[model samples]
Target chain A: MSEPTADLLVVEDDADVRASLERGLRLSGFAVRSAQDGPGALRAVHERVPDAVVLDLGLPGMDGVAVVSALRAMDHDVPVCVLSARDTVDDRVVGLEAGADDYVVKPFALAELVARLRALLRRGARAAPATTPELGEVLAVGPLRVDLARRTVHVGERAVDLTKREYELLVVLARNADVVLTRERLLELVWGYDFATDTNVVDVFVGYVRRKLEADGTPRLVHTVRGVGFVLREGG
Target chain B: MRRSPSDSTGAVPLSACSPARSMSLRLRVAVASALSATVVVVLAGVLASVLLAREQTERLDRSLVPGSPAVLGSFASTRADLAVTLRGPTGTVRRVSGPELPLSPVGIPTSVTVDGVDYRIRTAPGPTPGSLVTVGATEDDTRARVAERQRLVAGVGVAAVALAAGLGWLLAGRAVRPMRRLTEQAATLDDTTSAVRADGSRESEELADALSAMLARLHAEQERSTASLHAARDFAAAARHELRTPLTAMRTDLEVLRAHPDLPERDAVLDDVLRAQGRVEATLTALGQLAAGDLPDAGGGEPVGVADLLRLAAEDARRAHPELAVVVEEPGADVPESVRAALEGLRMALANAVVNAVRHGRAGSVVLGAHRGADGGVVLTVDDDGAGLPAGEREAVLGRFVRGSTAGGPGSGLGLALVAQQAARHGGGVRLEEAPGGGLRVSLALGPDRAG
Candidate 1:
């Protein structure tokens, strides 16, 4: 809170690669610092207290995943973004689950890494910072309702628990009730990718949101169109 | 469907002469034997007929011509339908016959009779013309005929010929048919599998069995060839891999040294190392390509331009061994790209031939020529007009690690083998023989897509 701008920690072993990254990121308008190995990277975290870290999976004295797990165990949700050269599905998954905010493969563009880091920073910075409405004041559905400011949901007199992606989808549908919302349009407005409607991500997530809302014979809100898309409707 | 190797158990080995055009063995033998036998039998019968007629005529002339028994002395009664005749002087013998004859000076005797019964007879003079004695008898009629026993003998001969022809056909079919197939299988004998067998096992049992056995043996040989080929490939790969490590280390060390600034005195060492590296790279690349089943000129394309490739290869030679001389001798329309690549590779191979010659002999000119071969194939001849390879080591040089007695320089010993390999890839090979003007001639002749 005392600093006007945030800091970024880069953990990699190869001196050539480390120098290349540090030079690139410094030019990219981020106050960047580097660690030669894994042990040095963890120690830098307490001293400098950076806004985010760009980490590598392969390390010398300490393992990269163990470092990430140790940081997360201390309840430090500082949004770490992993950068690795390993091109494998397992490597990405392990990085993400170890509390990395996002992961990028190496030989990646400098602009792309900077953009992803900015997105992580934006998440922490953009919190409305204004008069926010409470749940049930702005949203309700079929004896079920949500209060966004209060961070709670109500079904008649009861409440429910929903994950982040699920809550966002339901909120969009409840706000635009009784209207035909194509999966593409929903992905654009809610998930921020209209061009990626070809994926089944929309259907999977909608199903989860619908299940939570209709947990015990409550009224339904999500409707599916055969071979077309989905619509948010009430009572029909 | 993918038939199991075992499922090819009853494959018949077909041959080139397997009744494809000519008559079958059985038919040919049977027809010839039967016809020959018939001819002998018929000729014998005609000979017997002629001999019997001559002998009977001679015996009649001997008895009747000299016996002077007047044939007119026994003339008795005469009638239009009935005539009585008398024989002379033994006793008066009278005969009744069919008709009266007009009086004539001479008549050829047909049949004569005595007493009241007719007889088969013939007339003759009784030692003189005036006194005629008929010495003919009924025996002549029987002798003139084809006899029952002779007919029986002839019939038996004909029957024997028929039986012999039939037996010949069956036996020839049984014996020679399988042999034909066996020969065919042997000719086409790709010795690749275990069950090299002939078809129709039960019908052509003996032949099929023998053929199957032979094919099985040949197939065993084919398997041996395949195994040797695999072994060659593995050896090439292993040699390349093993040799490349040391070569790379050497090259890398040399490269590192050349990068340093203060090596003015070590220029000769650096140049030699670089040249050596180039040679090692070429060798390793060739060996690696060979091991990977991607031989030089492997793409079966059209005839390549011989002149262009030769020129290009000469450039390469000039760069590598500037001291050596390369000459191109050809005057024809440009060849195809495939031929060009092949000829290019061969040119490199031949350059080595000249390089070896130059390194050994005090001096020599390697002349390369291209022309249309007698077989309509593009012929390329590389000749080194120098101290040639010794007569005893002619074939030895084409084999691996076999350097000529004249060779002294340190080489990979794979140059000629590479040439041989490249020639083989083009469906041809290299021949080392006497040159036109007293030197070694290495003529690499390409065939019309046939493995010559």
Candidate 2:
């Protein structure tokens, strides 16, 4: 009708589900392209990087985790939301660890999925385009240093390698050094999740950032506040 | 009721007195050996006392008899306990020395009491025609010696019995060592241990072997149940996912219809929703059938005719798919009239196979056939001239919720699995092979035991 809000890709093995998802997303004011498997999803992304990707975790050939890993390996930096039939914690943890931004179990409400996709798209638009002039600033907390423009990190003299989500989480925590951020607050600020979800993804990502920051046996900069969330400070 | 408490209390002392009830095997063996030893020792002591008393009495009697007057006089004078006397033929005592000897039977020795002392006296023929010679001795000295010997024998018997009891206890301890070790090992057995070992005695070794065999069987049974439980869990998980996929689509379509009431292409959207709903219903039905098949059959098997099965399957195929050609091949004359099988289950399995051919295989024509198998059983086959699956996927598709690569259209993926389940229930198996002139052939072979 008017202008589509963003371009989205839906990848699922089930033909009926893929068609329904594509139609629903398009009707929700987004341009949609679809694929039925992992390799096809990758090919579609290679041809044109979508604003966001909706993926199913179980596929016939390569599966959704490998797809997410491949997308990240190619440095796409696109926001990905996974659909899983399994409601186990380990399943969500595995998908998130493979570079997925968010996940919703099957039989979820369309409204909920739409709301999460909107949040992710909004964040992607802001985070995309590394050439933005304001990104030249650097975030430093103790031995950790993050160059936002180069998308690089270093702890003292040792350069640290991190995934896209891990880097975003570290940057958010460093920007609020000495300030305790709850899990909910971090989910909203770092992952752009405005909706309430009982997910431990924030904890999982924080662990990744902590490992990389302390790889050289440096003093701990991220401290957990027990019942509270976490803080980025000079010392525990 | 009031006497019950006192009755129970009174029974406690009786139980306590019988220590054999709770005795250990080693201790019981030792006690039994000691009891037998005591019996033998006491019997031997009694026999020795009887013989000793008779021998002492005989020796006293021999000494009482005198060979001649000089010998008798000397024998009498040698011991204060002995006396010699002369008696006339009329049994009258004439002369006596020491104590008066009683006139006893001629040439016989007899025990008599004289002056409040026991004496053994014997009378023999004298040197004169009417005279008799009598010699007598007191029994006190002989009895004293015998009493001393008997006391000594009793003391020795006591020592022997004590020694026998001690030796029995020690020997029994050594003999029961292996049995005790075996008992300890058996007590410590647990689920993790698969074997029992006892190298002690023949009986203990045999007991250990039996125990190990039992443990192995139990372990195998436990593992089999565990595997089945895992299979059931995995099937549930797969069913859930299969149902959810369709439900998700249907929900999305329904939501879109509600969101946009006047949207164009509404009929198409409605059709998609209906199709997804149908898929969900089909999946649920298939899941129910699979679960039913998983349980042990309550109504056992019955005699099913070979030709009847084929003809019924052909009719079913024709009714379900009117556009497709259906044929029933005649069974061979050598084939048996009937075989034992779950009739309803076999009918359902065959119906599902026909449905698979028409829906997934896209077969225009189907053939139902039956004949005697090489194993002296029956073989039922469904041949379809449709798209056949690759060789590798044929085996996998028989499992629950697995589909063939060449399968077309939406299916519950449980048709072939149902067939496989029925085949197994009949003590047989299912195989997929190439039919003549292309297409697929499904061969279900029943075991020879099922032939009736």
lDDT of 2 by residue, A1-236 (tens): 34347889999988788888888888888889999889999999989999999999987769899999999888888999999988767777678788898888888777778888888887777666643537668988878888987878999989998877888888888889999999989989887888897667788788877887888799888899999999999976
Error of 1 at A154 (Å): 19
Candidate 1, residue B165: Cα displacement in angstroms equals: 13
lDDT (10s digit) by residue, model 1, range B128-236: 3244344333333445453644576678778878877887787777666655565556556443533334454344556657667776777777779999899887566
* Candidate 2: residue B381 lDDT (0-100): 87
Using lDDT as the measure, which candidate wins?
A: 2
> TM-score per candidate, in order?
0.32, 0.83
Chain B TM-scores across candidates: 0.41, 0.81
| Residue B437 lDDT in candidate 1 | 57
Q: What's the DockQ for every one of the candidates?
A: 0.01, 0.58
The candidate that wins on DockQ is 2
What's the distance in Å from true for residue B125, model 1? Answer: 11
